[model samples]
Each structure stands twice: as structure tokens, then as C-alpha cells.
Target: MIRGRITGSVVSTRKLINLVGSKFMEVEYLRGGVSESLIAVDLVGAGIGEEVLVVTGSSSLRALEKDAPADAVIVGIID
Candidate 1:
């Protein structure tokens, strides 16, 4: 799992059928103290600037449907 902050949101008019109802968020994570960003499927409703826990790879897909085609997913929102 990776800890990151929700930097923004992604607007998609069309996406894969499995991802139709999923919300997407832009997350900013630190790597070697340098910031990097990635779009993650939001399983937990996280707002902009909120801290969140993210899962990647197969774990991310498991967090959603059987095969969500997602590389990242927001699993938790930090208080």
C-alpha cells in the first residue's frame, strides 16, 4: 500500500464497462522526497487534499471488480 494525497479528480465521459460507476482521483505521492502523481480508482470517497491509502497492481483490481483494469485504487481515507 502507498500513502498519498488526493490532488484532484479525473473526468471521463467514456471508460471501460467494468469501470463505468467508479470515481477517479488524482493522487500525489512522494518518492525519494520527490512528488509523483497517478490516477487511482476511488473505492473510498476521498476529497481533494485528503490523505489516502492506495493499493496498486493486482491488489487494486481485487479492491474492485474481478478485473477492473486499474493499476491503482484508493482504499482508505486518512483522518
Candidate 2:
């Protein structure tokens, strides 16, 4: 899992069937106190300004499906 802060929300009027109802958020990836500013999909409900944990790769695919074509997914919210 990776740690990051939610910066904004992503909007797509048209998306894949699997992603039809899913939400995506822009996350500023943080490491060593620096931000990478990456965007990720949100399977769980997370809001801007909130710290979040993200999952990727096959593990993420297992959680949501690899065929979904998502690079990242918000797995949890951190206080």
C-alpha cells in the first residue's frame, strides 16, 4: 500500500461497465515528505483533504479485478 493525500476528484461521464459507478480521486503521492501527485481510482468512499492508502497491481486486481484497467484504487482512509 502507498500513502497519499486526496487532492481532488475525477469525473468521467463515460466509463467501462465495471467502472460505471466507481469514483476516482486525484491523490498526491507522498514519499520522503515529497508529493508525486498521482491520480487513482476509489473503490471506497474517500474525500479531498483526506489521507488515504492505495493498492495496485494484481492485488488491486484481485480486490476489484485486473480487467477493470485501473492503475490504482483507494483501499482505505487514514486518520
lDDT of 1 by residue, 9-35 (tens): 999987888788889999999999999
Off by over 4 Å in 1: none
TM-score of 1: 0.91
Model 2 agreement with the true structure over 19-50: per-residue lDDT tens digits: 87667898888678776876788877898999
Model 2 CA deviation exceeding 4 Å by range: 32-34, 65-67
Every candidate's lDDT:
0.89, 0.82
Clash pairs, candidate 2, are: none
What TM-score, over all chains together, does every model reach?
0.91, 0.80
Superposed Cα deviation of residue 49, candidate 1 (Å): 1.1
Scored against the true structure, residue 34 in model 2 reaches a CA lDDT of 72
Estimate candidate 1's alpha-carbon lDDT, on a 0 to 1 scale.
0.89
Compare the candidates by lDDT and give the number of the best one.
1
